[model samples]
Target: MTAAVRSTQQVFNLPDLGEGLTEAEIVAWRVAVGDVVEVDQPVVEVETAKAVVDVPCPYAGRVVALHGSPGELRPVGQPLITVAPLDDGADDAGRAGAGGADDPGGEPAGHAVYREEERAGSGNVLVGYGTGHGPAGRRRRRVGAARAGTGRRAAADDTAASTAALPEGHPTGTGAPVPTGAPAVVGDASAYRSRLDGELDAPLVISPLVRRLARERGIDLSAIRGSGPGGMIRRADLDARTGGPAGDGRGAGLAAVPDLRPAATAAATDAGADAGADEIVIPLRGVRKTIADKLSRSRREIPEVTIWVDVDATGLLATRAAINAAQPDRPVSLLALLARICVAGLRRYPQLNARVDGERGEIVQSGRIHLGIAAQTERGLLVPVLADVQRMDTGALSAALAETTAQARAGTLPPARLTGGTFTLNNYGVFGVDGSTPIINHPEAALLGIGRIVDKPWVVDGALAVRKVAEISLTFDHRVCDGGVAGGFLRFVADCVESPAVLIANV
Candidate 1:
């Protein structure tokens, strides 16, 4: 009778979500267990610190398991899903025997299955992970008949001997042999033992990130037993051994530090405990946590100064009205006009449109303007960038702004569009606010804030009259330039608002 071989399962880990984001919250799963999925099909929706993105599965197979549920955080390179190839139909005994003396190459049957699937895997690369192309006419070979008396250990020994026999630069089961001392990436639990039995003493680890975590924390992989399938070491294993939180990789290093702060007095402690009972604690995570970290870093690193000026926006509003009247189908917004004015100001004072490279002790001035429009969404505040704003006219800017704002509010903007801004333009006027000293988006030099354009008594042509006036505040990094340059930029913007002819003349 033919012995049955265990089906090889491929675990698809969460790929890096770009910009060095370490983890992502599983927003939703498109496929359930036992459901068939095709290569490049989106299996899950994940929200990174930057944006909500659909993660595509590289393997086309029946999903055996989903690693994380909605709202749970999964670290990059951690398993997101486990898929069993539809073509696999063998048991453990047959797999073991196939790797014995009967096979010339002595490679385990499971490794062959993995290689075949990978060769035909998804061509679409997700941020940082994907499989390579294989030959067009290569056909998959079936596992040979089981060699008698060859159990798991014998098969392991044969596989290890075969690996050792191969000379340097020769391909192993999966194209190239894993570099010595590096973690072995085994897809199947059955092959995990065989890989560990090889000449190398590396741990059975599939994720580079998990290995990096262990390396960073000075944790010995061989010492800690793996909690994952087939004794594969996972990040949780290291975290558990060190007594740190699953997400935090610092281990016990921080825990060992002594707390030198004076303890609260008995009465104060009692009062604080009573007050804490009524205090609600909301965890800062996802976009909120990201925003908090960035804002905190900006506050710590940037020496910022805020300067405000009340401008007569009557002409700006009138100009917007005239443009809309001319092109009724393409009505330009007040925010777009202000964006144009800001662009003009930036062109005049290029120093304000730059970032400080503190480490390099230099200011990097950008030749192009990538304008970030601050839009408050249900998720949080998002700044979708409009690349090369210097090349776009008022009409194009208006249309692009509307589309980007819509995408932001609907939470549909991609991760790439949410970054790379040289400057930011915030319209707090929508919230009926007069003015706000907005925080400068970190790395960028300045943020321009616009207040509501409302009817107010203003001195126009040396006479008091009710006019459409607004407050504009410029919060800039003091490191980039002095008040003279900042004041000049703000004055230019105000001039454009008071008389559109100034902007037209510059244009």
Candidate 2:
């Protein structure tokens, strides 16, 4: 027999996308198996809760396997792709057979093999995950000639363990028995570890908090199938299974609440048994899911108070008109003026431009305003930050805002642009709403809501006059300050809107 060829592979794990994000959804694959990729070459495009990012592979080699499919949410630190070295004389057929055609569910067999001199890497970092230019300190573990036989045996063991873990006669969601000698497709590596360690009863959970919650509620994790990437259970999945709000066990007592709606009861009774047919379920993922989670957390945690005032915006409108007329070629937007006003207000009342660090038991204030401007896009509501707005004038702010807004709408903003917001300014007036008790963006202390400016009767100089009027509302976290500070901030903003001279005097 000819000498056996030993092939080794390196696996790249998904790096943290920053801002404490735990996972990202695979939007598309730029490269497929058997394709050659250079170091730092983007192999996949992933959409995190904040932005769409192109994840580049660190290793320069031929791709042997892709870990997850498109639209699948992959947790950070999980294997993203597998790359085999070019010098390995494995043909395309051999490379394809690495996972074993008979073992269809088996993961590609190979440990991360780096060179003795140095580990191969791009040196170009993406977010927090990338290879570094450093000498390899550890010796490489080479698989012996028995690598193929060992992999096959491991696959058989994994398959048997998976089958034994399930209840008898239960379908494995595929409507067929798992093939022998094939490893089970799991949510993450932890599942494989659990099986190999003979801890089949142990649930695969990445979060300690989730485990604690399950323990507290006495909910069996093994019985529930995870809806997260690779069948890994998330907190949301637990909430759904327990029929309770996440973190809070209040949903446990939901049955104690009386259902007083007779009309709804009657409707349900009429549609009985077929009621499920009329229901349309939309799976929340990516940006939309992020929005829901943040908003819910904000509402639950923040003791928010909304204060509103109707301002005569005639002077503000006139000021904007004059500025645009003077320089028609470089016009400013009304939003820019409002942003300038917001900056001024925050400068005066710095308490509103801060976040509450609950863990530290301190109120963290910022010296510069990283203003978040809420813009509605086809993707969802995205707040792109304008860093250090205190340093930019109205014209500069306007130019930056326009460009950033365009990028946000086009879904081209990077993860950096979507975070580190110290304050937020929401121009909901574009949606024709007069006023709203908008939920504060979490971690940020306050949000300024601007409503539609329309012609309304105003008492100017104690006389009835038709003037452009608008409703301005401030929703602030009560943990930061009482109503006095909140009211002062709102009143100052209204003053700026009613009379541009007030804002100009401060500037």
Candidate 3:
């Protein structure tokens, strides 16, 4: 018996790609099955809630199958690649995460066999299996009223531990303040809320956010829930319940309310009756779909810890103004300026530019910096990268950024325009935010959030003076970096922003 040329198949699934360590959105495919692939080669591009990233191959073999079709939903641990072993033997189709062993779909392919130790550009080293356990822990849910004075709900993470350090310049969760004064019985809507109570096991299930929208519009989900599988609530479920097909439920309040003139028709008030037609109801496809996928993953995996720091951004603001005044013909926003600062800062503190290779069980430090810039669009958040940012001068980076964003906004951004970002920068500043503890893009150590820059009271030269300042927040993976390194990286970034001249690193 010629020992049946034992050839094994290696599989790679979508690895969680963010500090939130969440799911990924399949953005594009670089290769097809039946094609030969090398280990550490770019296989696909995925978008986290923050940036678009290229996931490289961990196996070197002939591509046998692909788990996710373009625009399809691929959960983490679901095989993404099937590679044939090198030998001619027919029995080698198994063996994935046991580091070079052959077992049929028994483990994740975090790193392909052969070159198992830490290697640059390897896809995220996932665990042998998916850890789909229930939510970890929760102190009683924070009520809406109790969440007063919250800095930003979208920015505050529920997982931030109390140990992370904060010195003022960074963004931290200032959870909505405790409700004060009277604890009055406020009654206005949904009886179902009290009916179901805590453990929601309704056959007709809908997220709280979705249910709130339905209640506000006077639309009932009970009828719609009946149409779905096991009474699951879908967007289309509610849509078809009404007379209009594909119509929005926003202004249906008036239609649903009964008329007092005819006692038979008297019902609830229509809060959004006849709202403008410009109002858009997004179907939550593509970019928005990407957001949902990533956010879900972040919440599922990883223990998150957040810290805040407040810095004197005057020097950085002055430098930005001076640079813009000097280079009037370029595309230089605070983001473009911040990217340069980050590139320089990473040179001083490489920890922020690194990622955790879990499957292969290694820590990686990247020498090059690829920056992802989060762009707000009609669809949702899309992160297009400014590749090799370290090599580009400030002016070159600014122009490239200008062109890339114009293309992104126009929906003309080519598929290539969205790939290969190693790190990300989300500028919430444009939205009037002072600071936020953003989730780091997966495989990348950290993500920097740029808050709105405004004049604020600052202690300058032993006196409180008005100074232009902005909040710079960094959310890093706790598994890969310690507070000392993360805080040091933040300090370096704050240094650059406080005085842009500091970015002139003697590279």
Task: State which candidate has the highest lDDT.
Answer: 2
Per-residue lDDT of 80 in model 1: 94
Ranking by TM-score: 1, 2, 3
Candidate 3: residue 31 lDDT (0-100): 52
Write model 3 residue lDDT over 396-429, tens digit each, in one string: 8888888777656544453445656677888887
For all predictions, the C-alpha RMSD in Å is 17.5, 15.4, 22.2
- Candidate 1 Cα misplacement greater than 4 A, ranges: 1-6, 86-119, 125-277
What TM-score would candidate 1 get against the native? 0.63
**Stronger candidate by TM-score (1 vs 3):** 1
Model 2 over residues 397-500: C-alpha lDDT tens digits? 99999989977775667667888999999999887779999999998999999999999999988899999999999999999999999999999999998888
lDDT of all predictions, in order shown? 0.69, 0.70, 0.54
lDDT per residue as tens, model 1, 1-507: 142312367788988676788999876565545345667666776778877656778787656678876668999999999876656544322433565544432334433322234336755645213323221101111111122232223333434433443333334533454332211222232334334334244455654345556655677887877775445576558667765443344566766553222211222232334334454344578777888888899999999999999999998889989999999998998889989999999999999899999899999999999999998875678888999999999999999999899767655576778789999999988777899988889989999999888999998779999999899999999988999999999999999999999999997
Whichever of 1 and 2 has more TM-score, that candidate is 1
lDDT of 2 at 32: 49
Lowest lDDT 10-residue stretch of candidate 1: 135-144
Worst 10 residues of 2 by lDDT: 136-145
Per-residue lDDT of 308 in model 3 = 64
